[model samples]
Target: MEKIVISESNYQIRKARIVRTKKLTPLETLFEIVLDGDRSLDHEPGQFIMVSLFGIGEAPISVASSPTMRDSFEICVRAVGRVTKALHALDAGDEIGIRGPYGKGFPIRIFEGNDLLIVAGGLGIAPLRSLIQYVLDNRRDFGKAHLLLGCKTPQDILFADELDQWRRRMDVQSEYIVDRAEQDWTGPVGLITTLIPGVHLEPERTFGVVVGPPVMYKFVIKELLAKNIPEHQIILSFERHMKCGMGKCGRCQIQNIYTCQDGPVFRYSAVKHMSEAF
Candidate 1:
């Protein structure tokens, strides 16, 4: 089978300018950007965009902003490679090239009226942020929502302002977990999976969207299943080494699926049989 091309000739950057760039931690930089024309990114919650650093290279980055915000989009980039490091050096008002709002985003509409359990770890919170914000912007569209966040330490938390907002919201339950803490930190200190047991949910009506390092899912999904969440109801997004945002690069292939094309997001039942997917 061939692949579905999201853009015929790769959409032009259309002049995206950085509105804000923050270094959340030693490894990550958060970019708040607007398409130069101020157009809607028109992305689904879990889809990704291909960002090009001319004369350097391109990489697939998840659109980290909620689709509900039509004017601009965001992506959290971790500096593990050259292109990412170059992106880190850019500042507000600096222009960058972009293509797509591609692949699948979380199935926000399907999970609309249903309860949702969001599990994020490390930089996993980046992509999950889109859905989490969407749910908040349209609180009445979904049932009870619970977010379980885990990171290396207190200083590693992302979207501090947004996390505070979610904490104060009446419709959502939010938990923050850390692997270790200093005296100034006071929160659950453990793996994110520990928070799952305490959430009140009807597994059948709930979808668990888990995003994290590939190593994190096996344990986290096992915990969600033990709590009676159906395998199919478990939603997951994978992190991969992506080259082209278009499927042709073959850099993001995970067995028969291209993490860049077939998914960055997939239902657990769809990949439960594919051990390569985490």
Candidate 2:
């Protein structure tokens, strides 16, 4: 195994090699990367890293793989902008710049021993994938694990194989919904909020972690609250325009909080009043 001493410099950009790549969709590509000298990212479940393409610039990409997989980490990138488009053009063995496993991640420590109800919508599944993998890796640590996922169409589903495994796994109760379905898609169809009504959970003992687009949050939170989950128990991972992994830049600021530092993940109670947070 390759070994590397983790760097402490916030500005230091480590060289990372793309060990594997899979084209999940025309627009999205999954890249499995490992740092030079094999240094582990050593990040928490929901933390994100700033991926740089040299002259192209840097973008904050979530660590899609779990920390349990110590050999490497993964990021699912969608080709929406310049840097990400360049990232999509890279092949295996290509190198990219990386800095930080920045910001606070999901509070897995607090979720321990509590039943977990995780919700992911569209690309939101990318970050939640880290948490799901960690929970499954240490399956015995929690009570019950339930996953609720929704996407625009069947082709938009992120991890088909892993989703199937989770659905079939006796340990996790998983259900997926899609707004529109292809003829071959046989899964549940509707908004993700639809799945919440049928879930069997003890509200007081459950910690609900949600990650999705802005429009999805209010509806999902409403359903989670209807189930009686506490305000603090409802966690959310927000996807905002984060520039500069450090808090210096105001791009990711919502009121007084910096999404890049204070959070990308927050307890709903903390952001409920922040109009910018949505």
Tens-digit lDDT string for candidate 2 (1-278): 11223346756899999999999988899999999999998999999999999899999999999999998999999999999999999999999999998888998889999999999998999999999999999998998999999999998988888898888999999999999987888888889999998999999999999998999999999999999999999999988887787777799988888888888899999989997789
User: lDDT of candidate 1?
Assistant: 0.86
**Tens-digit lDDT track of model 1 for 1-278:** 24656666355655588999888778888898988768788888888888888888887788888888887788999997878889998999898888887787788779989999999998889889988888888999999999999998988888888899999988889999999998888787988888888988898999999999888999999999998999989999987888776678788887888887788888999889888675
Question: Lowest-scoring 10 consecutive residues by lDDT in candidate 1?
Answer: 1-10
lDDT of each: 0.86, 0.91
Q: What ranges in model 1 sit over 4 Å off?
A: 1-5, 9-13
RMSD of each: 1.7, 4.1
TM-score of each: 0.95, 0.96
- Which portions of model 2 miss their true places by more than 4 Å? 1-8
Best model number under lDDT: 2
TM-score between model 2 and native: 0.96
